[model samples]
Target: MERIVCLLIFIIFNVVAQDEFIFWAELSNKNFILHHQNETISMAMTKSKNKTLEYACEITYVQNDFKEKMYDDFGVIAEEKMTKLDKFNFLNIHKNDLIDCFFNSKIDVKDFVKSEQTYVQSETYVRILPLRFVVEFHDNSAFIYYLK
Candidate 1:
């Protein structure tokens, strides 16, 4: 009976592992941050402007806090944050320079948020706007986006 139970457990573990492996392996690599998230890292990208490479990252683990407000205000919008990031520190770095910084430096979740909320959880985002400079080489189109 014990042997049978152990076999069942092993089968269950194998199935779960296979599902996880498939989920991560099948994701698109067009975006680096998303690609990393699949490897057990949590991150998100925000809007970028034309010819600019700067993107915003969400550091909080709390999802969907502003959903109702977004739908009521903008009509069925996606994730929106009540917090506004300080532009002075992050934006002082130019788009191209920022991308270089992200590649070289290790990012922390606190780097993106304005407040310290213990229960809210946290995430990190690496700005990928500088990638736009290389997009033409990859045959990519210009995309405009605004995060809610």
Candidate 2:
């Protein structure tokens, strides 16, 4: 019974550590899209009135995609998609610092990216719950990671 209890504790600790690692690893990636509950968060940066850059953690969704033919003579089309789904913004002054801190950690960023790609390529959706996130990828032929 004592051995069993120790095993359970180890499992719990490892699970918690993995969750924390995923959270930080995703944030460190430049093209990270995270969904928690019913909202999605993506990093965006803009210049403030003083011209100093300000960063935003906001929610956004893709509404539609518009494709226009660049030239009638050729088969090239320029595509553009835009959507805004910000219910609220959390302005963190040290967001970059937080991301940088992860880079300095022992977590392997390349492994994280590779693992994410494998999930994205899977036919079925992947869920990392308790955080309650659904990693739904589109276009299986090309690994595109998007969350819903």
**TM-scores for all predictions:** 0.16, 0.17
The global C-alpha lDDT for each of the candidates, from Candidate 1 onward, is 0.28, 0.27
Query: Between which residue pairs do clashes occur in model 1?
Result: 53-129, 53-130, 54-129, 59-123, 79-148, 80-148
Top-scoring candidate (lDDT): 1
Please give, for residues 1-148, the per-residue lDDT of candidate 1 as tens digits: 9999999876666444221110011122222243443222111122223433333322221233233433334453322222122121122223333233344323333233334565333344543221211110011111211221
Q: CA lDDT of 49 in candidate 1? A: 35
After the best TM-score superposition of candidate 2, give how far the Cα of residue 93 lies from its true spot, in angstroms: 3.1
Output the number of the TM-score-best candidate. 2
TM accuracy, model 1: 0.16
Candidate 2's clash total is 0
Q: For candidate 1, which ten residues in a row score worst on lDDT?
A: 18-27
Every candidate's CA RMSD: 21.4, 20.4
Candidate 2 C-alpha lDDT tens digits along 45-65: 221132222221222223221
